[model samples]
Structures are given as C-alpha cells and as structure tokens.
Target: MRSEFERRHPGVRIQIENIPGEGQYVPKLLMMFVAKKAPDVMHLDASYASVFIDNDLLLDLTPEIKSDDSFRLDDYFTNVVDVARRGDKLFAIPLDFTPIVLYYNKRLFDEAKVAYPAKGWNCDDFLAKAKALTIDNHKEPGKKQYGMHFINWMPLWIPWVWTEGGDVLSPDGRHAEGYFDSDKTIRAVEFLASLITKYHVAPTHSEAAAAGVDLFRAGRAAMHIAGHWMIIDYRSDGIDFGVAMLPTNAASPKTVVYESGLAINRSTKKRELAWEYVKFMTSAEVQKVRVSGGLAISAQKEVAQYYASDEQERTFLNAVEFASGPWGARVEPYAVVEDLGREMMEDIVNGTPVPDAVHKTCRLIDLELSQQ
Candidate 1:
C-alpha cells in the first residue's frame, strides 16, 4: 500500500511504523502525540475514537469526505460509519471490522444427535441445545464435555445485555442509573450465570484457564460465541466448525461490532497527502487484497464479497448487517465501564447474588460517569 501510494504521488515518500499489538499501540501513539511527533496517518480503534475526539487530537474528515466525488459514505454500513462520527462530523474512515457470531462444533452436534442451530434461533433454543449437549462424568468417566464456552470479557457478555433488551448506559450517554441495574439487564446477567452455576453447561473462569486448552478448539465445547477472527485459526487446526447468527432473546438478534479506521492527526502539516493515503488504504483494490488474504472483513461492501467462499464465511458477512458498535463508542471513561463490567461478571461467577452485583456495579459506573 505504501509503495502504491508513493507511486501515485511523485516526490512524496511514505514510511510505515508498525505497532506490535493493541496493548502497546495506544500508549505509544499518545506519547508521540504529546511530543507533536505523531504520524500524519494512523489507525484508531473504534472504541477509543471518542477519547481522541474529546481531546481535540483527531482531524475532522467531514469536509474531505464531502468534497471527494469518488467516496460515497453511504456505500459502507451505516452503523459502522456512525462509529467514526461524533454527531455529524466524521473523524476517520473504517478499514476493516469483525462482528461477533455463534461458532458451533459440527462434530459435537452430530455425536449428540442434536440438530445444528438454525437461523433466527432464540434463547430458548440455545438453552435446549446446550442442555442436550452437556455431558457429565457419570455419562462418560474421565471425560466431560461442556455445551458452550464463554470468556469473561465485556464484549462477550454485552451481547447478552443487548439481546435481553437492556443497555449499559442511557441513550444520551450521560448516566447509567436505571439502564445498568434495570430488571432486564439483571435478567441477562442471571441467565449468563445460570450457564455455569445452574445448568453447568459452561466451564467457570478458573476451570477454563486450568484446562490449558481452548474448549472450542479442543472440541470439548459445542458452541462458542466469538468474532470472525477465529475462523482462520480454527480452520488451520482442523476443527469442524460452523457459524450462525447469535440467538435472539427478548429483542431482535444483535452482536457487538469492532472496527479499526484510519485517521489523520489534527495538527499535521500534510493534511492533503494524509487524506490521499487514507483514501487509497480504504479503496476497493486495497480492501480486496486484504480480504483475499483472509486478514479481516473489509470495510468496503464490494470488496467484502471475496470472502464468501463458504456458508460459514457468508454467515459472518451477513452478521455485519445487524451488528452494533460497543458502548465505548458513545460513553466517555469507557475503560472504567469495562473494568466494572468485568468485575461484576466475576462477582456473579463467584456466587454473588445477580441483583446485588448489578446494583453495585451500576452505582460504581454512575459514580465514574459523574466524575467525568
């Protein structure tokens, strides 16, 4: 991409500095920003765009997008594009995204004589299949297979909240007073907890870690609710897996969407050149190259068609239509919200009353938002 961009524009050179991982990427970028030495063009996680925008550190791309005849913002998914905006102004253009979906082990379903999950299955259907697939030691000595595997992460659990018709914060993103502690949200937490404490269909946090194997990859769990990034790794491992949309609950089916976009530093002297690079990076040619290589779901709708070689891969592309961005896109102090959310889940897994955990976490989130 750098070579092509340089070829397109004579006398202009592009140097790429790759950051290893998300853990070190954000801090290093922040330090560079503080020193006014940040790159003219950089990638920003959708979750942290609000923070950079709040700090007035990101360039507003609205004018450039509006003026460019070749860039049709409507061609991209509405929700994904919305994540890069703070009201009417766009700060970046998304390059790629991955939406959460249901990944099931076909071998396990066949062995249990259970039908594969169909489209638009509800929570009741999920529970029934999970119960049927779970195997106890009495059934088979020294081998116990769980029905589902859930990692204790905010992104994994937030879909439960959304499916149950609940949210972590208010629509205006000001407070979490009633939303987080409401009956619907508590019910979601209770249902997730039931997978461990009540139904015994999923492994506890400690048990999963101690097992030293990914339950889904090892074929010890029948279903895993995760993102598209796992497809390549699972395929390489020779696991017989299939994909389906996340089951519906009280509301329509929903899942969390994660995306990374390219944005320019607000203080850059080379705004024109940076915009050109951003346009080229998200262009159909570049996106096609990325999708063909199985890197990620491309941001362009036209380029995304390259990945639909199988039904499972097609399921992932279809899932993007209904996926919504994470709560951090709207709420400030999202790190605090994420930490408190994980802590609340841990409390539930440790046997704290669901209602009590929800109430306490709600208060803590409200306090954090108030201070901001």
Candidate 2:
C-alpha cells in the first residue's frame, strides 16, 4: 500500500513504521510525537484514536475537507466517518469498519429444522432458536452440539446488554455508577449467565477452555455474536454461514463498530501531501482492493456494495446504518473497563451472585475512571 502512494510522488519516500501488537502502538507513537519525530501519515484505529486526539498529537482534517472540492465525505458510511470527529473537528477518513452482528451456521440450522434468524427478532426469539438447535449427545459426547457460543470478552457481549438498554458507562463517559449496576444491567447480566448455566445451550467457560478451539468455527455451536472479521476464517473452513442483526429486547437494534482510518501528524511538514495521502488511502479505488480479502466492510458505501457479492456481505452493509462507535474510541481508560467486565462475568459463572458481581464491578470501573 505504501509503494502505491510513493509512486505518485516521484521524489518523496513514504516511510512506513509497522507496529506489531496492541498496548504498544500508542505509547511508541506518543514517544515519537514527544521527540518531534512522528511520521507524516499514520494508520489509526477508532478504538484508541482518542489518546492521540485528546493530546492534540494528530491533525484535524476539517480545513483539508473544506479546501478539497473533489473529495466527498458522502462516499463513506456516516457512522464510521463520525468515529474520529469531536464536535466541529474531524481527524480521520475511515478506511474500513466492522459492525458486531450475530453469525449462525446454516447447515446446523437446517439439520435442526429450525428457521433461520431474521432482522428485528427479539431476545425471546433468539432463545427459542438456541434451545431447538442444541443437541446433547450423551453417548457420543465428542459430537455434542451447543446452541450458542459464549465468550467472556466484554466488547463482544456488550451489544446484548445495550439491546436491553443497559450500559457500563454514562453517555458523557463520566461514570458507571447507575449504568453498570442498574436493574436493567443486572437482568442483562443474569440472562447471559443463564444461557450457559441454566439453559445449558452455551458452554461454560471451563468447558470451552477444555475444547481449546473456537466452537463456532469448529461447527460445534449454532450461533455466535461477533464482528465481520470472522468471515474470512468461516469461509476458509467451508462453513455455510449467515449473518443477521443481533436480537434486541428494546425498540431497536444496537451494536458497536470497530473501524480503522488514516490520519496526519500535527507536526508534519508535508501537511498537504499527508492530506492527499489520507484521501488516496480512503478512495473508493483503493478501498475496492482492500475489501477484496473480506477483512472488513469498506467505509465507502459504494465500495461496500461493490465488495458485497452475496447476501451475507450485504447484511454487514445494512448493519452499518444502526451501529455506533465503541467506547474505547472515546474513553482512554477503556481497556481497564473491559478487564473489569470480564472479571465480573467470571465471578458470576463461578457461583457469585449476579447482583454482587455487578455491584463490585461497577464500583471498580468507577474507581478506574476516577484515576483517569
């Protein structure tokens, strides 16, 4: 991708710094900025973009957007484009995004003679399908089937809580007092726990660990809640899969969007060139190449349609309209929040009272936020 850009600017060299893992990228990038040696252009994830933006280490692209008459912001999905925006200032042009959705095994649903999931299905409908699809093979234990796949990852499961009108943080990202331990949140937490413990449709944490593989990908589970990125592996495994809007208990569906974009350093000497580079990377022509691998839904609406060869892919495009940005996109200490959420779930699954677990977790989350 860097080579493609360098070819356009004959004398210029686009030096790419590849940071290899999470928890390291932001610190390394921040150090570069502190030392006045940051790169002109950087690949930014919407989740951690807040750290850089809050410190004013990245350039606001609003002026460039106004000056460039040929560039069109309408080309991209509106939800994703707003990820890097803070009031009047825009920071990045979205390259791609993945909205969290429910993935189901078509083969399993057919085998169970269960109807496929449809949009606007409620939590009751989801539970009924899950119950029907589950198979307990006491004789052939290795061939047992589960209705749903459960993972304790907070980000992946938060949408369920959201659909129930519960959240871990306030709208302004201030505190978690009323949100995380509220009556609605407690119900959401207990309901998720019941899927594994009481309903026995989803595997327990210990059972999943014993399996040592992705139950959904391995065809041992009928339903999984995840983002678009899982499609690559599912297709490679030859699994006939379908995507659907997550079941909601509220008036509407709610899901989180994880996105990646391009940004310019505030100190870059080649400001205009950096802006051009950002535009080029997010251009529909470039996005077409990027989404061919099924990595993510292109932020460009037209490119997303071009990328969608089948109904499964089209569902992702439809989902983009209802998805909202993740909390990590704006809250700097969200990693700590995620840790607490996981711990709370673990406590519940291991015999702790749901109310007690939520109360403890909510208090810890507030303490973590106070430190920030």
Deviation from native of the Cα of residue 88 in model 1, angstroms: 1.4
TM-score on alpha carbons, each prediction: 0.96, 0.97
Model 2 TM-score, 2 decimals: 0.97
lDDT of 2: 0.90
Flag clash pairs in model 2: none
Writing each residue's lDDT as its tens digit, candidate 2 over 1-372 gives: 778888888887877788878678988988888899899989889878888888888899999999999899988888999988999898889999999999999999999999999879999999999999899999987667999999999989988889899988999998999999899999999999989878989998988888889999989999999988999999999999999999999988888899999999998999999998899889998998988898898999999988788999888888888899888878888878988999889888998999999999999999999998
Reference-based TM-score, model 1: 0.96
- Who wins the lDDT comparison? 2
* Worst window of 10 by summed lDDT in candidate 2: 14-23
Cα error, candidate 1, residue 146 (Å): 0.8
